[model samples]
Target: MRVSSSIDSIYQNNVTLAQDLKSFVDTHIISNKYEKWHYISRIKSLESFALKLERGGISSSSTSLDDFFACTIVVENSTQIDKAKDLVNKFCDIKCKRPNSNNFTHKQSSSFEFDDLRLYVTIKDDVTVPNEQIKKIVFEIQIKTFLFHAWTIAVHDLTYKSDEINWGKQRVAYQIRAVLEQAECAIADILNLSKLPQLDKNNKETKALNKILNVFKNHFNKIDLPSDLVRLCSNTSLLLNQFEVKENQLDAFLKAETSAGRGTKMLGLSPYQIVLLGIFYQCEDKLLSVLMGEIKLSIKIVITRELLDFIQPDIRKFILDNSIPGIIVLA
Candidate 1:
């Protein structure tokens, strides 16, 4: 009974340490905005601890629980994985690093695979706890893309934590892993294409574009559209600035359109469609053509005929004169 009590105490202390480490890591990652979505897990049961002990043997002085605590950070894509690794290396002391790989049965491929980092942190001496009691607390951190995480979960479910060598299932798992790798690459490419180039927050043009977006947000009172507007504005601003479309010109154009009874109709259109109309009214044929090609087909349809009815007469004439293909028109 005494020995069991001691083991329980050790497990409890380790759980506490794991929670502390998770809090610290979460604070750092969440502050960055890009690395906010992450997961943390600890070995709470003695049975799991005993399994670790049996597999690896007792190596730590402050119980084997230290080796069993871990956290995983799943970012959006491969580039974010690199960003996360850099962030972890900046604050935490890395014990070992396992970069991304494709092999299914590779030693690093199982859990900490694909651009993952393992960090070792030590509790500070300034804490009130006695040095001898909680001196050797260490935990693991794993980082990967969301796609890689999903693949790992699928593979783990199939394998079921067994050590038996099942060749047929192993081959199937390897093939599935390979396909997932390709899917990850394809997703990363699509994300890259869809993402607007980062805008300089301090730039005058960017500030102007943001003001236009704010006007839409304030008028609409919706949350989802603002971000989509920002992306569209960023892309349009890049093209429009080349023609010297100053902030005041955009403001004047917006006011004229609003006075002409366009603003009320804009409330019905998705943010992207509004941006498209704004660009069509303000930009030349060449730029408008380029933008038309860039916009996704699904978003292009979001601007219904009733919404297009709100466009300034000259702009409507320009569209009719140019006869832009795929530009929806009402009968």
Candidate 2:
């Protein structure tokens, strides 16, 4: 039988590891009631599954000769890293497979495994979350802030400066480091801001951000649309605007991609530009659906059946009543 890249969930250790990690994160690190954290293992597992076909087996894929790579779970904000600790445990089983002519060579194929996993624990006065359950030697959980993510983007761009290892990235590396420094500051700012007595309009950044939103909100309401979705939509718009997106029209946003845990995203179109005004983007339907087309949906349907299987019946019913068409699948 072909050694499967598939995560052997049937193994008791894997299950125990996942549950233990989940419990640790939910209890210790994600203590902030308002903060969000998630499990990003299945993503890693699935990608390794595909890659295992090319390598002789999972054995060829790692130093341990038995384990496979998994996916990254995202940290939604900048303050979660404050809760991250070096509390992870590891388990190694060397009875694994190895790579060969039959293995896949394409590096960008999978979103399942990342260099590490990040667990964002909320930084609040009320509770201290846990971080003890992680047990895979190959998997790492990071506690990063939003700023950390932005810095990562810049650092990634810097890594490709030249073929030379060190000197090639000299000038750009400074700017990359700047962005990382900013991430540290941003993380600190959010952490401090969370402790504020209350949010106020007089705040400089808050005011500036709110003013930006007001302009967009007024623009959105002129067309008669729901305002609640504006924050997410506006977040998308502000990012484009920063890039000097001269073309405000959604048609200009021909690029839409979705990662395993990232859900779905598009450039060029506001949620307003698509769903509110009625536009559609189409893609090739396959195991991976990101094949590009012109007919784009204003809003991509993010609710997949896999996600629905995890919800409580009562919550699922609530989502059915409130969620949009094609966004979530019904039970």
Q: Compose the digit string of candidate 1's lDDT tens values, residues 1-331.
A: 1235555565665666656655665565567536356664544456656555456654535533446566677788776766776766665555544433434345644433234445555444443342334435655667777777787787775665666868677677777776777777777787565564662125676678877666555545565455467676765465445445554465565666567555435677665455456655556554455435653222222345755676667656665565454455652
Model 1 spans > 4 angstroms off: 1-13, 26-36, 63-66, 99-117, 121-136, 162-165, 188-226, 229-331
Error of 1 at 70 (Å): 0.7
lDDT of 2 by residue, 1-331 (tens): 3434343433323544544444544454234323454423432344444455356554422322223323233455544433333322112222221221224633344221222233222222232334332422343344344444555555655565334567546555555655565566656587577667784226554544555455445444444444465465555454434333322343323332222211123233344333221212222132012112222334444444545443445545655676443343534
What are the lDDT scores of the predictions, listed in order? 0.57, 0.39
Which candidate gets the maximum lDDT versus the true structure?
A: 1
What residue runs in model 2 are displaced by over 4 Å at the alpha carbon? 1-71, 76-78, 82-137, 157-170, 190-331
TM-score for each predicted model, relative to the true structure: 0.49, 0.27
Backbone clashes for every candidate come to: 1, 40
> In model 2, where is the ten-residue run with the lowest total lDDT?
279-288
lDDT of 1 at 186: 72
Candidate 2, residue 323: how far the Cα is off, in Å: 32
**True-vs-predicted CA distance for residue 11, candidate 1, Å:** 3.5
